[model samples]
Target: MEGMNGRSVRGVEGYTRWSLISLAVGEPVLLWLLLHTLHDGGSALAGPGVAVLAVLVLAHTAACIHAMIAALRRVDPDRGRRGLLPLAATTAAVLVAVVVVLPLDGPAEPVLASIPRASAVAVIGLATIGALSARWPMRILAALTVVVLALVTLTQLGSRIGGIIYLLPAYALVLVSMIASFRLTVWLLEVVRELEVSRESHASLAVAEERLRIARDIHDVVGRGLSVVAVKSELAATLASRGDERAEREMREVRQVAQDSLEQVRTLVSGYRATDLGTELAGARAVLDATGIRVTVTGSADGASPAAQDALGAVVREAVTNVVRHARATWCTLELGAPGGRGAPGVEDGEWCLVVANDGSRGDGAGPGTGVDAVVPGNGLRGLAERLTPLGGTLTTTRSDGVFTLTASVPSRETA
Candidate 1:
């Protein structure tokens, strides 16, 4: 589930709180068990032994409580070893108490009464440490605990083989359950850590992808604008050298191209610019006309939706930019049409198609074009294709008979 700030909330973050709750509830249960043990088992010991047993029980309880607190702080591996010290103290106290109060000559009732005490020994030592320690160490500690308990139980039961067999299984079962609980809680914490790392990785990937898209957009904007500026400035210089009267007008047009390119670059950097079909057509005509190319545009742009317009406009801009930069031909044609009409045969119905074709794309009758090969798409065409893919459109390029053609088609609906 998402948190208030829109980040995903981790269920595992509640682990420490739940652990405290379990410890709180388990605290009362442990107290009740201790009281019952003292009330019932007190009869088996004298006044001095009873006092010692109480002190031992209290020490063991305190040690277990301390270990549990340390376990919470033991998330760092460096602190885990420090946490184990308290659990070791708890184990020592439990073992000492068990040795002192063990009744070999007592009746079966006193012997049976000692079972709770033995179980407490396991719970206090094994449960706290098992939960905090890494898996391998936890297993080693668990094995040592089981072994010590088996020896203690065997000593108390004496020569009764059947009693030893029955009581050992009960002791093993209790210790195993406590250890398993600890392991499961630790595993849950590991899963939560992994999920947090995965979330961070996904965020980083998203940022990198966005950076790539912006770089592509900037390259398309600046590269096309600069291409036009270069062509117009060169044309102005050529006319000036020939002492023509129109050289001053061509220089003025070059200055205008430079000014427009600057404004477009500023809009692109600020991310407020949107490509429009009308604007692209006007820009294309001006750029091609300045370069002395006959630019003929034949299409009804009003029939296309806003999304189709943007996609087709981007195609037009990029294609026209390529014509100025790479294609050396004297004539360029741009056509727009609804699907399945005589103007756009082989197009699907209810779709809009844009066509940009130029004969100047052929170069030296050897490469794809005369001066530059327009058949091989630059960054502009690739970026245009990328933008169109998500809008259910396709950009296709083909070259034949020294002519390079760029076609872009999209669904007729407006995109939000």
Candidate 2:
């Protein structure tokens, strides 16, 4: 995805660069027409004068193309400096060509004189539009229209008002169209670049979020088991010192816990670790009972769909882990049913709900109805919320009196 987005952005940039270069190259064709006109009009300097003019037009075209490439690459920091030579060359060429051809006597003299000047303006405008902002090219175009009209009027001695009127709107329309095309292309290229950056940022965020998920899963899978192992191992050592026969059994239990934790970690890393609600409930009961905390489970996991069961199982695992590690309760109650009975807002009839409530909460400075925010820190419950939210579920926690309650709900297959 990242590579494709980057290539798309680069493609837009390449297309824009070539488009600007094409415009720059094509605009000078008008200068060639001016040369052809001079030759056909039988101007005396058409021989060497045309050659000089041709050289000037070629130089202007080369400079304009170079300026446009530089601007598109954004390599030259001083854009105005980069465009200076092209603008200067075009100005000198236009003045020389116009002055040399002004004395020609023909019905086409005024129109012919205006061609070199107007074409020079267009060439310089295309060049600077690439290097500079749209406003600079617009100013140059405006000046081109004004200069062309004045030259046409002065050359005809104001006797051709019809020609001036005809040329005014036509020149403005052509120049505006060209400038708009260039500006819109550049704008589109910029938008593509921004989209590429945004795509990269989103990819980075996804990576960070995944890392957080793995960390949370490791904690839920391994932390409480390690705590149990430590407690049992210490008791086993004491019982061994006392020559108790049960010490061997406790050590064996520790090994089993370690093995189970190792398997869970492997499965978690492989991304196929699914939690069955019934299995999770049994494990929660066994883990809590081993710690001398009474566990009561209500409601069957049968009616719920696999997705809802998996999500609720994660909630149960994390909640049980928190109860074992963070709370001092003598008892924990696990319940599963429809949230409609509990009057949970926005919960439909077919939604499966899991409630884990324990009395030994250490308070942890969390307030009542704190939802995900007031839960024990470290992405346990928060990660479960992240998991459930995409399934149209919610995770919330509340600390009231001496109990910390975690409630998770998800839609069943029928409702989903």
Candidate 3:
């Protein structure tokens, strides 16, 4: 346990120092270490052999100290910590080199203090770079290690082959391991990023789908109930002048319908849906009539496909919604027709078409529907378009002075 604890602490300290060194000066120390390992000890670990090892180790130790200082400054560039790291690293490196290079002082045994110290420092530097950089750079370092070994094995006239024999293979092995580890890390990062993007896209699509669902529900519930209420109220008003008991009953029915409408509206707003074509048409007419606007709905087939009906339904709803909100007109018309030879502009569709038009708003400046704002289809129009697309259909809306129009066209299954 004690041994493990000691190793853990050493590893941590080594990592911290190593990071500092690389930040201070890119790869100089590592380079020097490689150089010395290649050139040092010409089969004799004494004299010049010792000197070479001593210089390499000492230089690395210095680099490590310098790196620590640089890292600290990088983390916090201002204040008193500025020059301290550089100074400390330089002092440490020099002192360490001297201790390692020189033999033990006095009449005892030969001791180079920096041997252990240099090893510790180099380890720290190596670890820090590995920790800080992504895997690609590490792998490159690893693969190039082969080249470095090849360089070592080559003789330069006076250079001896003894040192390269052992150290070259060791360095090559370390390089291979490091490169593989880094490559794995890089692969992992890419995977994580892709996952994150996919998750975000899914979340966005879900939100959009939810909003579409809510809008459809609202159109079904509130739209239908409101239509019924309008019809009953109109019937009651007409009967009021005739002195009929049925008129009073119609008024009560209107009130009941209004209440039902409110409840349905609330339910739809809360994400409930129960849709029917009749209700939607009725709702559209009622809404238009409430504004004293004439409303007309015409379609040839109740036998229309599910897709066609939905497309038609969306057009009517959007037309009503716009006329009620923006057109401010006293008259609106809905026209549905079968697929014909003449294709509608803006829609590449080749099928039946749904057209809803209202007397244009009389407002000064411009009509309620034109330009970019014309495409300013309320959520209903946009949703209709999407729903129609699955049915291989299209919806087109247009507005002229005091006239608002919506067209929903579905390509027949053959064209689709």
Global lDDT scores for all candidate models: 0.64, 0.68, 0.53
lDDT of 1 by residue, 1-416 (tens): 11111122234545643663364346335634654655665536556765666666556556555555555542665554564665567557656765666444333453444454454444444444444433436667666766757664655454444455555676567666656666677676666565556655765886799899988887787778778778877887888899877878877887887788788788876554565787788878866764557789877777677777778888887888888777776788988877655445446777788888888755443543443333566789889989888888878776666777788888787545
For residues 395-416, write the lDDT of model 3, one tens digit per residue: 6665554455666778655333
TM-score for each model:
0.48, 0.49, 0.31
Model 3: residues with Cα > 4 Å off, grouped in runs: 1-160, 189-208, 225-257, 266-416
Enumerate clash totals for all models, in the order shown: 7, 2, 16
Q: Rank the candidates by TM-score, best first.
A: 2, 1, 3
CA RMSD, predictions in order: 20.8, 19.3, 23.0
* Comparison by lDDT, 1 against 2, better one: 2
10 residues in a row with least lDDT, candidate 1: 1-10
- How high a TM-score does candidate 2 get? 0.49
Per-residue error (Å), model 3, residue 212? 2.9
Q: Sorted on lDDT, highest at the top, how do the candidates line up?
A: 2, 1, 3
Candidate 2 lDDT (Cα, 0 to 1):
0.68
Relative to the true structure, candidate 3 reaches a TM of 0.31
